[model samples]
Target: MESHVVKIVDIQQVTHDVKSFRLEKPAGYTFVPGQATEVAINKEGWQNERRPFTFTSLNHEPTLQFTIKRYADHDGVTNQIHQLVAGDELILHDVWGAIEYKGPGYFIAGGAGITPFIAILRQLHRDNQLAGNTLFFSNKTAADVIYEKELSNMLGKNAHYILSREQKAGYENGIINADYLRSQATDFSKHFYVCGPDKMIADINAALEKLGASADNVVFEK
Candidate 1:
């Protein structure tokens, strides 16, 4: 497999636990919105610890960006990634992903799963096709919501924030299930894009299926 060692140009804290890494794009390297690649930190003893991360930056952008959340619970790749800074190097593999924008639909994401939709929504907003799309982002708390300001500005009232563990004044307090989906969505026939933990995805997909949505119309990472 082809791999490129790219240098990190910049790093910014996106949320309390999430960080955005802007890496120097390799010439001729390109990927569609919502696509992802295997990434490994170019450090001793960690060079082969590759993990899949979605590109949050648009394909046309000069820099490739990855919006990653650091999981400090275990001594793992994400924990290692949080220690890196600008000028650090990373090994990136070929781009491949199952999630792609098919059309305007409901975008359901959980926590860091919002990474894939970042590029897709940005591309849509850039192309003036953000209408008819709605985003349902569910996180543990307000501090866990990544790109809140940017998402609000870009999506306007179409964005819905749900806090599973904290009930903020402006956000909804609950999980995204059949009840929630049925309450907010009027058209079950429309496409539904979902990305999250495996259980959440399975539950949401099953709920959508039971809510009169066609199985083929639901898009997700498969």
Candidate 2:
């Protein structure tokens, strides 16, 4: 597969553990909003340790961007990513992902799973088509919600925050299960986009199916 070596032009901390990396976009590179590319830091010993990261920048943007969450407990690619700064280089492989926007519907995401929807929602907002879509984002705590202010501004009342660990005012508490889905969603027939841990996705898919949503209408990363 073809790979592009790009330099990190900028870096911004989106949350306590998540950082946004802006990299130089290669000429002729293009990708759908929800697509992701395998990325590896351009350094010895770790150059082959590639990980999939969604493109958070719009296709028309001059540069590429990735919003990554660092898992400090593990000696993994993301943990290494947190140690990088501007001027660092990375190798980006071919773009591929199963998650894509189907239509106006509810977006259910857990923690870093929100990365894939970042570009999709940004593109929709740029085109003024973000009215019918709602986002249900779940995190351990309010501080863990990446781009909370931006998502709220783009989705307005359609943005719902669910905290599974720390419960605070203005945020829903507990896991997003069949009960929560039924109570907050009025239309079970609409499309449902889900992304998160594999188990969470499986559970949500089952819940969606039990709630009268067809398998064909549910979109997720495979």
Candidate 3:
């Protein structure tokens, strides 16, 4: 696999734990929205510790961006990433993902899972094709929601936020189960994009299937 070393140009905190890192885009490097590449910090002893991260920047953008959530509880790559700043370098491997956009439909994401849809939704917004899509984003609390303002501006009333831990006005409360999905979306025939933790993905997939959605219509990382 080919790898390119890119320098971090800037870093912006998107949430309490999520940070967006903008890196130098390599020459001739290209990727479709929703695809991700394996990334490793260009540091001794950590150069081989590659982790998959989705691209949050558009292809036309001069720099590549990754919105990552740090798990400080564990001594992991993301924790290391949170400590990086401008002038740091990272190695990016080949881009690959299966969460491509098929059509305007419901996008169900949990916490950091929203990273993959960031680029895809941004592209759709830029092209003025974001009208038919609806995003059902669930987080533990309002503070945990990433790009909340941007997503709301992009999708308007289509941006739905559900808080699983906190109950607040203007946000739905509870987990996104089969009943929740059924209440929010009536059409199970439309395409569904889901991403999150392994268990969340599995549960959502089963819920979608139980709601009469065909397995072929659901798009997710396999």
Candidate 4:
């Protein structure tokens, strides 16, 4: 496998705990919207500690972007990654086959899982193919929603926000179960894109199947 050492170009604080890092795109290092590559910081004591991160940037863009959520408790890779600056360097490996866009449908994401869908939705919006897509983003609180403004701008009223722990004025409450899906989803045959923790993915996929979505029509990190 080959590797590329790239320099960070910019960093933006997306949410309270999430960050967007823009990095130099190595020549010929193209990746699909939902693909990811193993990444490691180039600083001492961290060169070989690689973790997979989804590319949130479009394939045709000159720079690469990664939206990452920091885990202060873990004190591991993400914590160290959050401390990186614009002049820092990172090592990236070849891209891996991850989630892919398969036409318009409902996109369901939990917490940091929204990273992959960001690229897909952006690409679709740029191509003028975002009309039929719906986004259902679930989080613990209002502050945990990443790219809230951007998603709402791109999706308009199709963007749904659900809070499992907090009940806000306009956001929906309760978990996304079969009953909730059956009530909200108008078309059962549409493709379902689900991403998040393994348990959440399994539960949502099962619920989608129960609500008449076919297993083959479900797109995930499998």
Q: TM-score per candidate, in order? A: 0.98, 0.99, 0.99, 0.98
Against the unseen true structure, what C-alpha lDDT does each candidate score? 0.94, 0.95, 0.95, 0.92
Model 4 stretches with alpha carbons more than 4 Å out: none
lDDT of 1 by residue, 10-110 (tens): 99988888999999999999999999999999999999999999999998889999999999999899999889989999999999975988888899999
> Cα lDDT of model 4 overall?
0.92
- How well is each residue in 93-159 modelled by candidate 4, as lDDT tens digits? 9999789988879999998999989999999999999989999998999999999999999999999
Off by over 4 Å in 3: none
Off by over 4 Å in 1: none
The better-scoring model by lDDT among 2 and 4 is 2
Q: For model 2, how does the per-residue alpha-carbon lDDT over 1-222 read when each residue is reduced to its tens digit?
A: 999999999999888899999999999999999999999999999899999999999999999999999999989999999999899999999989658898999999999999999999999999999988999999999999999999999998999999999989999899899999999998988999999999999999999999999899999998
lDDT (Cα) of model 1 = 0.94
Clashes of each: 0, 0, 0, 0
The per-residue C-alpha lDDT of model 2 at residue 67 equals 96
Two-way TM-score contest, 2 vs 4, winner: 2
